[model samples]
Target: MRDASSGNALSDTMEVNDETQAPGASWLPRGDDWVLQLSGAWRGQRAALPELPAQDFNGAVAVDAEALRSWDAGLAAQLWQQLDPLARRSVTLDLQGLPQGLQEVLALALHDAPPTEEAAVGPAHGPLERLGERTKTWWADHRKTLTFVGEVLLSMGRWVRGKSDMRTSDLMWQIEQTGPRSLPIVSLVCFLVGLIVAYMGAAQLQRFGAQNFIADLVTVGVVREVAALLVGIVLAGRVGAAFAAQIGSMRANEEVDALTTLGVNPFDFLVLPRVLALLIVGPMLTAFGAAVGMAVGWLVAVGIYGVTPLEYVYASVESLTLPHVVVGLIKGTVYAVLVALAGCLQGMAAGRSAQAVGDATTASVVQAIVWIVVAASVLTVVFQRLDF
Candidate 1:
């Protein structure tokens, strides 16, 4: 007979003996049991056994492999194919005649197989559930941020007590990064801003024949606000992003974890130097920016507004008081702290991926800029209200 599955003759490899028959299997009904009989060399050529016909039998099905000469996983696989049909008819298998090794192999294959689609049922989530999950995640993030801030503060306290593990060289290097290297950009931005202010003030004042006041406008604006604000924004984009990318890469490479494993506080070893450097550099940059801005204003007033060089210098100097410079420096110091904290916090929290480092760098710059604006607004209001 032709095997329905492979369209091959079932007796192709069968050999008949004078007193016994060649290898094959036969199914027979015996009362409440189904007996499957096997015989001969059930290997190699016999591996491509025909699929079993679907049956509607009840009770137990027993395999009889005693007369079999040899077998392999192929035979085991063929036998396994018969199991599901028996299971569908509520029949239990009697695998007593199967070799222990074959039985174990079959058992393992069945055990590791993925669950059927019917077994993967799950409940669906509602919109409220998703919203609650998001809220919880946000709260957790805020809590972690506050904890990081507290750790940084504690590190600073330890440094003040002369018990910090931070290296002086690291502090110096960070100061160089945030200070001298940044002067050109700071000076350029301040000078352009001063020129713009002088041009605008001269335009309005010239209409009223008071163009000489352009010096006062540029001086007061630069000393009290514009120069410091411009420097803060520049550093936020430059130093803050650098800090975030550097620390985020270290986090990704597990170097920060290594420091922790070695009993070194990352807040002290990594964060303190950055914060202290920015704090020291912020005022210095602000002062330099103010000077450059005043020089630019002098140029505008002398060259464009028909004011004498000495008179422009005197008006610029007279327009700025110590209190105005002090306020600018204070704003710079606060802006520096905000920028450093934003970068460091985002860096330490970065995930272990290239994309995450980039994201943290972007976030650091954005957060630093936002905090600087907010700080400047609040400080401006307070300084004005106090009549400074």
Candidate 2:
């Protein structure tokens, strides 16, 4: 072989021509120079480069990409892997035949030539530093939650003015989900709690020959606190998790982004319906739970404790005021709003991954329950001060 332009005879030339081979680069020894020939369509995952030989070649390397029909980032990556090692060994590289774009990409890829070194590991933060970091994170989260709540309130205002984009059918469906479908669990848990309260109260009252007062204990407790609290906790785990998982999955799939692209407000279309539905249904569920709870108390008082049914009913009714019922319903409504907000916030902030959806669902349930408990405590204190 000979160089046509230089008219120089080329001896000891090594030719690597394999037509059936996959897209790759091959190095051939020719005197003091090594010709790195890249062939076939070097595109995407299909571009395969062979492993470099273990033996060191102390010579110049010339890249020959004239046989390349097409190329992409994969081709650049393959070339970089080969060229990086050669450059480490101080071998000169001639990227003459490669496309200008590919040459630019390769140059940019390996511009920061750092000699490989062991990864440095830092010491863990002290307790005070960790606490400060946590406090900062909590404050940031609180601000985000407040902003989300404000957006939801604004969306509700839009709904009130009939300017919201949320569909009526979606709202109705949400109501149905949070309302009637929740009755069975609420009834069961409230009834059990009422029975437990009655039994415990009766045991103490019987010792003092004041068993008749069991009705007062059961009724006041169930109506004023237990029923609403139990319902809130139940919905926090059940309905709150559902809301988070649903919206988080939508976020993971970019459906929420699609809604934004279509000029739809996610707070109006998604969050508002859920919040309103839970708010409207919370009192209804609480009332149902309270009634079932009271009925269980009545059964315990009349059947086991030997109290007359009429006397039991009279005592229970007399112990409960309109204010007690109002307070419990108010708590239920507040808890519902908190649960919806927590779930929606977690869902909206979810990362784009399957694991993120699961994390959001778990966080939503936990946050909803914590908020419910905190709100319950505050409401109790306020109601007590007002003597409700």
Candidate 3:
């Protein structure tokens, strides 16, 4: 067939490469010039240009896209792949024969301009600007934390009113996990700590012939500070990480979303029970750990040291006052709240992946530990100020 526009006929039959199915390309001879013909809808993931022929074009080539109905970034990418090398090798590209939009796009793709000065150096920020940016990030993070805390408080209020989705069974299970099951480890740790305290105190007190004072040291130290602090650290590692892992896995599986779709508040169903369980069980554990530690201290004092059992018992009883026990219980309560908050916050904010769940679990443990320590320090300072 003759070309009607310029009366020039295609002399050679060019077939589209089989690899490129729909949006294909072929080199057609139009008079003395070679026209690269592009046809079909050059869009979507499957659209691609044909493979480059082994025969190199020494002369300029014209792009004939009159048959192309539509195009997208995929076509632009393909055109760049096929035409960039030829242009780099000194072959001129006649984009005028292509669509206006395609021609303009190709111009940008084929250009070899150097980077502008602003782009090369980038925007400079002073120390004040950097500080402002950091402050903004800090504010954003703390705002999210405060919002989560407020939501948790509201959930607790709802539970108190008996209008929440929190289950009695879930609370009992969490209590069992954080309480009785944790006793062996807590007992072992507190026993070892008491042994060390009693041994060290006896070693120093023997020089002064005041072996009876070892009872005072063990009782005051363990009940007022050591037992509560150790229990908090233990639970931060044990229970806090477990909460994060459980909730994060639920988040990854879209179970949290499913709960929300069912008009259930995840805070009520998931977080409140864990927090309440810890709140109820933590003080009990702290008191138990303190009693265990004091008993071990008594054994060490009366067994190894020459202090009489009656004298050691009398000293320990004198040191174990109401204020000391109250302080330890209060610290345990605060640590429990912090642990629950850290674990639930990280789990709820977790991303939807296995790695993300693992990361959230790790972060929850670290955050719980840090919060426990900070709260301990603050409580210590306050207690000291009050002369408790």
Candidate 4:
């Protein structure tokens, strides 16, 4: 071959590496600087470059732009696997004249930023800027989370109102279960209490030559304190535990989610009934406990102390006032609401886990006890100021 500008021979050859060659083929070259391409073998093979023709016009070998493009594209495809991403990227950018796709890929490589690696061992101040930025952003980023505290307060309100509207099933159950069923125990305990008080009082009174006054002392103490405090304590355990268990179970089963999906108010559906029921049952139970306690005192006085029934009745009439009964009932009702509210609130606040439920239950019991003690003390002070 010779260039028209100047007569000269040209040489070019295509060679394939053994790894890139066709199956079961041997490579051989047959030409001067240009040889017939062998199928495979890198030992004596290399792709020939475009030969310099006799003239600088270079007519020795024809170059196909499309062929070079195809070759470049193939090389680019393997870039990612063969080189570090940035290195591959640099290569790609250097060869960006290949195609639109290659250009985009190269641009992506150059512009792409790696996530800053969190170094287990690095410069101490490397993270200082990020931490400072976050601290600066903390208020803005966490505004919603902080505002959610207000939402929790709102939740408490909704819970309180919901409790106020509870269905009577639990409340009625408590009354029927706590009061009616507890009557025998109350009566027995009250009687023994009365007997003990009478004995204790009479022993002292007899020393003072006023044994007949034992009935008055037992009647007054039982009515003024024991009935109210005992009823509140019993309700704290029974009703408080029930409220926690009920609400906690619903939370565990995703009943709260069901309520959300159904667009039903969970507070209205769950808490209201219980709250209202307690409002109704509380005073009644207190009265029941008080009556039984008084009867116990009577039995203790007349049977054990040998106090005449007429004398017992007389002292009770004189010493036991209406204020005592009224105060007991009022305290019981208040305590009932406090305990129920605490239990339900804690339960509803529980997370969706067994441990959460247990935590809620424990918190509910503790809160109920605290509320009861505080309420009792407050009521005592208030009543002492007003009635005593």
Candidate 5:
């Protein structure tokens, strides 16, 4: 930098705050170079400082702050705003004349400043890229679920060998919760479903003077499909959500970690009993729901539709086959397993927070319902193909 004392005054100093002399800058000629003179207090937004000289900086430039009494970031900002463009234009800058602190601030600002132009945007993802990302996410989620299922299976093996931590009392409590405690809602729903089916069937059958056949329709439908589906749906909403919330809350409180520390298999102690309880109760509930639905259908047919009670009973008896009952119970078992798996998987993988427990509970219900529907469809298709 050219010495500020050796520079020749080129123009009168531009006074920004003449009354207070808040801060100002001036231009001077130094042979083939230029000198910027700064003076007065330049702290914060105390007062406006002089605008940068309009003259072009086509040679080496030096900032001279010998008269700068005190300053702050405000001064640094002004210098950057004014001198950054000149530096980009290849003007040799010598800021040594400024205070060391100000020089450092200016150096950092100039080094990290964003480009004057707008940044270019990245390209949009193609269909293949989006598909790949979705596939990866799907695999990640299912991998966790599969791992949980494997753990459950191993726990089941230990259970069979009488080496599991599953408690008989726990299993019985779960059975009470999943079976008897659930009967009221299951009965109400199935009865209403039966009433609807019977009414719909009677409406059409009455047209043909064949209202007696309403028993056949309701019996076959309820026993083979509706009862199991309604029971599964009820269990998914009630039992599945409960399992998730219980386990997830345990996880949030670090009880699951405590179990691991104590050498207890969490899957055995927490999950297997619940799963076994559901397995034992699932078919029983399906049968109960079927009976409730069939009874309600008989009431609708006999009392509302004026069909002969004896004929309705006879038709229902004729339509109720062992194969249909077996298929419905099998479906119930599968749905029960799926609901338990979904709930336990989400709970075990949940984050350690109340919100995560809530999310796991919600996800368990949703996943159970989805799996039940898919399983129902697949089972129906396979049974049809096999003539079962």
Candidate 6:
């Protein structure tokens, strides 16, 4: 920002070989850009420059044909040839994307001549400033649409803390609605998952004389990954879709509006109980699924390896640590929040149309599953780094 030298123009006193030289070896003005001359110099130099002025780019692009009458076509190319990418980067920044004020300045300059060095800064601010301000206001207005989230969670805490008029019946109803109703599918899928994983582990470890470790392998792998994932998939389709559908149905019927008319908070009465219920049931179902998976795996292990049931159980238990179990529970809890939040948010935001309700339900399942997988993978990486 300060002056490069307090004195005069620079002088290249050293006599370097002229033939071994760069094409456009001219010094830029101290802070200015792309204002090069054909005569190369510091001060005392015979420079053969290839650079062009910053202000003449568009003028060069589709210029007046009459302006070229004084010179041949070869002269125009020699005078204003296409720049290399690096030079184009610098040159276009000053010329091609000219602001309105800069465009006016440039137009006026064409009527007269190239701008004097002092007039190079043609405009102060560009159009992006107003665009930025509008973007800020747009974000602020949309943020209010999501204010119901915090209130929903607060109402959940109240229900958890107190035993009164706090939707305990609804909580049980939801557990019945989501977890109990999903038992058949959950059981079947977990069983298949267990069978598949156990078969794979056994086949590989058997080749290495580590067949007995199959129980341990199945135990750790199920608890850490498959169990939590099974619970999450069920929650995404079962509990999540249900939340979206219920709230969306209420929205369609204007029951949520009726609650506001009666001075009963919609978030507390509707979303709170559902969210709290899912959080409570998610960890329980995950543990239940993990137990079932391990049971199925043990059956296969005992039957195939001729290992005793007692030995398989002992080996599986011995192979696992408290940390692995804790990690699975933690993952389940995280998935519960994401699934419930996604479903409730989509449902509450859902349009009044029946199709909108279905859309919300579908979106909730997809988003919950995606976010759950991402969170689980990140947690897995973090846990591996922890080396526990």
**Residue-wise C-alpha lDDT for candidate 3, range 1-388, written one tens digit per residue:** 3356334322221234323335767877655456789877666757456665543444566788877767887788788778766655546569987778878888866664222322222223677765665666568778989999999999999998989999999999999998999899889999998889889988999999989899999999999898998899888888999999999999989999999999999999999999999999999989998998899999989999878999999999998899999999999888888898999999998777676789889989999999988899999999999998
TM-score winner between candidates 1 and 2: 2
Q: In model 4, which residue pairs have backbone atoms overlapping below 3 Å?
A: 162-272, 165-272, 165-273, 166-272, 166-273, 166-274, 167-273, 191-296
Global lDDT scores for all candidate models: 0.81, 0.83, 0.83, 0.58, 0.84, 0.67
- Candidate order, lDDT descending: 5, 3, 2, 1, 6, 4
Angstrom error at residue 109, model 3:
29
lDDT tens readout by residue for model 4, 1-388? 2474243221221223323442221212223221112222222233332222321110121111222312343333343232223231222113322346654664444342221222211223547875765564566434643453344445447766754333446456655754566556555655566566666777788777776887777777777777666666666676777777778878878998898788766666666555556667777766766667667767766776677888888878888677877777788788877776777777677666565677678877887888889998998999899855
RMSD of each: 15.5, 11.6, 13.3, 22.6, 14.9, 19.4
Model 2 clashing residue pairs (backbone): none
Compose the digit string of candidate 1's lDDT tens values, residues 1-388.
Answer: 3356444343443323411334577877778677777777666635454444435444577778888777776788787667644432335667777778876765544432222222222111567765665566568767988998899999999999999989999999999999999998998898888889888888899999997798888888888898889999999999999999999999889999999999999999999999999999999999899899888888888888799988887887788889989998998888888899999998998766676789889989998999899999999999999998
- Minimum summed lDDT over a 10-residue window in model 4 is located at 55-64
lDDT of 5 by residue, 1-70 (tens): 4556334332224333442456767878887788888877777655554554544544687899888878
lDDT by residue for model 2 (47-101), tens: 5677655345546878888878778887787788878766544466787688999
Candidate 1 stretches with Cα past 4 Å from truth are: 1-138
TM-score of each: 0.67, 0.69, 0.69, 0.55, 0.69, 0.61
Q: Alpha-carbon error at 30 in model 4, in Å?
A: 67
lDDT of candidate 1 vs native?
0.81
- In the range 1-388, model 6's lDDT, one tens digit per residue, is 2345422223232333232232233324423444332221122333333444454333223121211112223322333333323232223323333234433544433331222222232232455754565555557534743576677767767666773244568768876776777777778889999999998888898888887888888899888778889988888998899899989888878898998898777777777777777787778777878888898889888988767888898998897789989998888878887888888887887766676688789978998999898998899999999986
| Runs off by more than 4 Å, candidate 4 | 1-195
Q: Compute the lDDT of residue 124 as modeled in candidate 4.
A: 34
